[model samples]
Target chain A: MTPPPAPVDDFDLHGYVDHQLPPARREEVATYLAANPEAAARVADYQSQNQALGAAFEGVLAEPVPPAMLTRRRPWLGAITRIAAALALLFTGGTAGWLAHDSLLAPSAIERTVAEPAAYAHRAFAGEFRHPVEIWGDNEPHLVTWLSSRLGMPVRPPDLNQAGYWLVGGRLLPARGGAAAQFMYQDDKGGRITLYVRTGIIGNSESRFQFFDQQGVRLVYWVDGPVGYALTGPVDREHLLHAAQLAYGQTKR
Target chain B: MDDIAQQISEQIPHLRRYARALARDRTRADDLVQDCLERAWSRLHLWQPGSNLKAWLFTILHNLHANQVRKLKRALDNVPLSESHLSASTPATQMQQLEVKGITDALQRLSEEQRAVVLLVGLEEMSYQEAAKVLDVPIGTVMSRLHRGRERVRQLLADQGQPVLRRVK
Candidate 1:
């Protein structure tokens, strides 16, 4: 005789189809499917849609990344160098000309410190089994004051609750010949993300926000005025950026 | 290539893949990728090191596509499905191909926002939250769009009424 089917009174079928359910919930979906043939068919149909979409677009990935996209940077820079070379040849009669390329390529001490430390500290402490943070987020004021004093600036733990993460805690980190601060947060889901804050690393200038994926962890970091921030998480890129944006907004304010 | 350039370059294939799904026209897709690459290259300094470059590129591509849609009064469409790729003459295989094309066509018929959520969540296999972040929308919006878009595709494909694999005995 067959056993009775499991109930899914509280399980989200949409979440199952979307594949966003956590493991145990996903298993619940699987169990639900085994009991109900119609629901199983619906899930199969959803899978086929995904399969069809994947198959159709699969060609695009095999096709070359279009040389134009790759070479976009070359033209303008090439044009400038060509023009400069032309002018030098015309004026100097075959003498080699200096292009000021060295200065442009060099990273300032502060710029070097900004991004590297955050990444380093993230990789180091993010995987810690215990003591992931030096100062827990329990006492917000103390964590802020302690990190701020160590970094020689008034730093505040950016409130990330809006972006679906609450402060798990923070840690003082050694980075780029200076002290940096790391604040951790977790969403209602088991997702964990951290904000790496380096203060007075650069002059008052704006920098672009960029993302990097190291191993499996995702990060997005930017520098603003004298503060550089990197938000790291083992979540998808969009989620990490959401946390990063929230942290930036909190710190900025 | 410099390390930064290499990292950025590595993301081009996936970017192209996403662009193709979004545009559904090879030339238009390539142009979108080109524009995205140019923007990324120019703003290279803005990208934070050790962060996700692929997500950044997708974000750029999504914004560009959104702006282009707005300007063109939303020409979001896909080329009609053709059986030209199918060489097999077996009736079963032909039916399979037809079903596949049916879903593809149905996907294109969705509204741009809904279609985007489907392609991102289905093809790219992004989490709902990731798609939301890329589209700059709330996760609830992503879920609704994905569910509706997916359900519509199923209806159009007759996945509920007509069995995709087996006929009613």
Candidate 2:
């Protein structure tokens, strides 16, 4: 009437429950359990619980995708198509308007340089973080001075005095036509704004302004004399334009 | 195209069932399955020809579920930590029948990882190696999670006054 010694290791109990042991080893455990009622009862409880859990969730394997979600397309594909359409428009009839306007007001020139910044800002706001910006906002002075010199115009970082954003810094960038400048700014909540600038000639014309929205990011560009300025970010259209206007006022002064 | 689409269509029922079991709610389970199918379609290029598409789909679905759990922080307080008594309809029912509901509620309390491991091995009747592959974990981890998950459920049921049934050894 003596009980058998408890299995030296708990793994034997698991192995027995899971049927993981080789035939001979499993037989030994089975024979041992035959002599030990307490252990056998515990093992049975474990098995039943396992079965019930399986029954509950096994049904999930057969569920169908709802029709609405199935038809939903990838977000990136739509954005890419929009960008391609914009580029096509710029290259076709907008070329004359681009040439007649002042070099800084030329939409084509600004569009080429600002495309990436606009796309990046849109993505950043859309919650894509891996490549939010090529450079961090920690080197503001160098970014401003370097960008200013490259654009051949005295560039001053816009003072977001009332706006919640702060100057993070900037980085040099390669644009569609020439070297470009990207000045980065961040707000308290980690939202970001990028200003892209480049120099180009568009048939010697007067300065003008252009606005565009892509995937929730707003972009404002203007030709001032021979320099093109583009402001890109997730700010509302009015706010982004106001920021652009503020930058213009400071630079013109 | 029709054949591929048809094959995917055939698997939807089982996928729904598995998702329901995982989410425990009908709407959330369907949403999860829909998301899984969308991902599977986009990544169809990566699927090898003639392989067990069902297993591949399951792996993708499980990973997607895990990602959602992490992103939403859904697992943070969902674990079952206590035993609750099942409601009695007549109070004259057998003890074994009384504990069934408690056991199910206890299963819902397991961590997502433990629940997934248990479902794959215990319910789906998959081998440790196969379940490990689907879960993208080591077999040892799967075994350990399954063991812990099962023990917790049993302990919860026992605490709820379920009479332990002795198997004739």
Q: Which candidate leads in lDDT? A: 1
The window of 10 residues in a row where model 1 chain A has the poorest summed lDDT is A99-108
Docking class of 2: incorrect
C-alpha lDDT of residue B78 in model 2: 29
- Model 1 lDDT at residue A30: 86
lDDT against the true structure, each candidate: 0.66, 0.60
Per-candidate TM-scores read 0.49, 0.47
Listed in order, the DockQ scores are 0.16, 0.13
Candidate 2: tens digits of C-alpha lDDT, residues A8-33: 34567777777877886787788888
Model 2: how far residue B143 lies from native, Å: 1.0
Highest-scoring model, DockQ = 1
Per-residue C-alpha lDDT of model 1 across residues A64-179, encoded as one tens digit per residue: 66566676565467557656645654475322122222112212222245444555565566656578777778888898888777877788888877777788788887654456
Candidate 2 residue-wise lDDT, B36-128, digit = tens: 777787788898879878778889878866654453232112212111111212234444555555655675677788878777666666778
The segments of candidate 2 whose C-alpha lies over 4 angstroms from its true place after superposition are A1-9, A19-21, A54-253, B1-7, B74-100, B163-169
Clashing pairs in 1: A134-A171, A208-B46, A210-B47, A210-B48, A211-B51, A211-B52, A212-B51, A212-B52, A213-B51
